[model samples]
Target chain A: MTYCVGLRMKRGLVFMSDTRTNAGVDNISTFRKMHTWCVPGERLVTLMTAGNLATTQAVISVLEERSKAQGERNPSILEQPSMFQVARLVGETLREVISERSTQGQAADSAFGATIIVGGQIDPGPPRLFLIYPEGNFIEASEDTPFFQIGETKYGRPMLLRGFSEDLTFPDAIKLLLVSFDSTLKANLSVGMPFDLQTYVADSFEIGHEDRITRDNPYYNEISEGWGRALREALGQLPPYDMG
Target chain B: MTYCVGLRMKRGLVFMSDTRTNAGVDNISTFRKMHTWCVPGERLVTLMTAGNLATTQAVISVLEERSKAQGERNPSILEQPSMFQVARLVGETLREVISERSTQGQAADSAFGATIIVGGQIDPGPPRLFLIYPEGNFIEASEDTPFFQIGETKYGRPMLLRGFSEDLTFPDAIKLLLVSFDSTLKANLSVGMPFDLQTYVADSFEIGHEDRITRDNPYYNEISEGWGRALREALGQLPPYDMG
Candidate 1:
């Protein structure tokens, strides 16, 4: 299992993902699930994936290979004209990978499935965020739903639903995602640290900031401990149930 | 879908369950998923169920009818020697119902399965909680896991993990449960209002209190609103992320 989130705020987009992957309880391993592609000032795209590691890695490998090619031998995410087209290219590539695996005798729906969150900006348009399904279809984030979470989503969703706003500042947005991720990490063992986090400031057409938050990161520790204490304090403050 | 929780505390046991049942989004209905059986001064047992409504209802109905029968025509929960035995009875009954449905050509695992949380106290024994599965097996909640939640569980679990304690007061336990339930309700359309809440005080050998909290309940409204405000305020108080 995995937990990845992409938030599309008015100022920019925020992407965060956990690094733990497991084929089973005994075969746990660390793998980076966040991938980035950039043409510098022309375009910047970030992809976060969850599900079968082999399938997601294959899809990423295909995209990476295409991006490094010199000419039009194959269309690459770098060559996409808009964020929407970039999402389409990623979705199609993911479908092709899963299809190949299926033809090799693996079940498409269960064994080779993966979900992707694509967010970035191309020179011609505003930044966008999309959640691409295993079947190669996708949905864009809207004002009503400014965030998309894939993988072990439910444990952390309440915090997002309660705290998210379209106009949140970058700092506040990251804090919100941290709280959400903290909740998931505490409740589920499959979603472990360190987390990969990246932010794209609006209209920059470049990555704003990126960091890998490990268990020893002081700031991450502070957020985790502080949020836990604050939640307990808040529960303490709620009016006691009336037994009458 | 449903969300029901049972908490075992030093002072007593707390049980809360949402009443919504659905066969899909369009076929939603309200049905009590919490049932209680009491021998007044002898014992008090509460069962909260989740999963297929037909299987759960059949299990509960059979228990209810047997309890009302005279002259020991059949063994009933009233005749159980201990809360553990009561759980075993419930588990066996659930398994029997599913097996009967399976013999009628339904797939027992998928279509006729039900999960139950049973908590109560009988004379000469301490209060206990057990989670009964469809296969007639059960596990008791221990100090490590003081609460059990069935159905739509993930969204609300973090709160319980953070707030629960073996020594919580009855009122505090109920408050924690309401917070958990509120989170589930906000994130899921399938689990909705009017909740059944019951508390059993230690050594009382009978229910301490019970209430049906509906949408118009004022205290419920206060807790819901206050929790939302508290969470947002806590988020605001967290130190802002440094971009360095």
Candidate 2:
């Protein structure tokens, strides 16, 4: 299981993902799920994956190799004219990886499936966000839906639904994402600490504040502990039910 | 999908369940899922069901018939001397209904499986709570685990885990449960409104407050709207994340 979310705010886009990966309850390891590619002033791309680890890693490796100067570069994500094309390339790469694994008769196609969230700015195009499915099709975030979440999403969704706004600032967006992640971490063991966070500003063509939040991060601890008390007090403030 | 919960507090037991049942997204109907059988001063039992509606209704029908004075009363739940025996009878009845459906070759065994939460008190016994599985096995709720929820449970669980306390009053417990249910209702279309609620006080040997909360129920409306503001305020009160 994994938890990853990308929010498209008025300021820009903010992405956060947990690093824990597990084959089963007995076997667990940490692997970064967020990958980034930036050509400084030209473009900035961020991708977060959730699902079969092998499939995601293969797709990432293929994208990385194609972007290299000495290798095949015809279909490189970095060279795509628009964020839409970059999303298409990533989707096709994910589909290709899954089909390749299944053709070897290693496992069923569904066993190698993965979902992805790819978003960022490409030159003159405005910053955009998309949730790419295992089938290789994708949908962009819009006014009605300003965010995307994949893997272990339910526990953290209510807060996100109620709190998101177009006028949110970079700091508040990060705070919201942390609260969502904190709820998930406390409820499920599969999603662990050492979170990767990256923010992008509209038209900046460069990544904004980025950090790796560790288990003992002072701010993370404060939010986790303080939110509980806040919720209790909030509950107390509601008028008592008239059980007449 | 459904949502039903039975919570045990020092004051006694509280139960709530949504009434929406569906064969598919297009076919949905409201059906009461909370069933109660009480002998007034002798015993009080409340059972909440989730899963195959047919199996649950059959089990409830059988229990009701046996409890009638005009029919077989030998193994009736009202005659049970202890809450444990009542739990065992309910579990066995559930298993019987499921196997009977499958033996007729109607469908797979799992298609008729149902899970139940039955808890109350009989003469000479303290209030107790039990969660019964489809296999005719059951587990009692202890101090460490004082609540049982079935169907569409994840969306509403984090709040229950954080809010439940042995020393909680009935009003506070109901408030917590309403907040939990409101979260589930908003997140899932399959779990709809007109919720049924029942509460039992320890050693009373009879049901206490019982109410059917409809969509326009003023207090529910208040809680649902108030919770959004309360949560937003709570988030604002938490120390802002330092994106340094």
Q: Write the per-residue lDDT of candidate 1 for residues A1-244, one digit (tens) a residue.
A: 9999999998999999999999778889999999998878888999999999998998988887755656644537878889999899999999998888888864445678999999999998999999999999999999899999999999999999999998999889999999999999998899999999999998898888999999998988899999988999999889999897
Off by over 4 Å in 2: A66-75, A108-110, B66-75, B108-110
TM-score of chain A of 1: 0.94
Q: Model 2 over residues A1-244: C-alpha lDDT tens digits?
A: 8999999988899999999999888999999999999989989999999999998999998998845676555437778999999999999999898888878865553488899999999999999999999889899999999999999999999889888887888888888889889889988999998999999999899989999999898898898888788888988999877778
Q: Clashing pairs in model 2?
A: none
DockQ for candidate 2, please give it: 0.75
DockQ of each: 0.86, 0.75
| Model 2 chain A lowest lDDT segment of ten | A66-75
Docking class of 2: medium
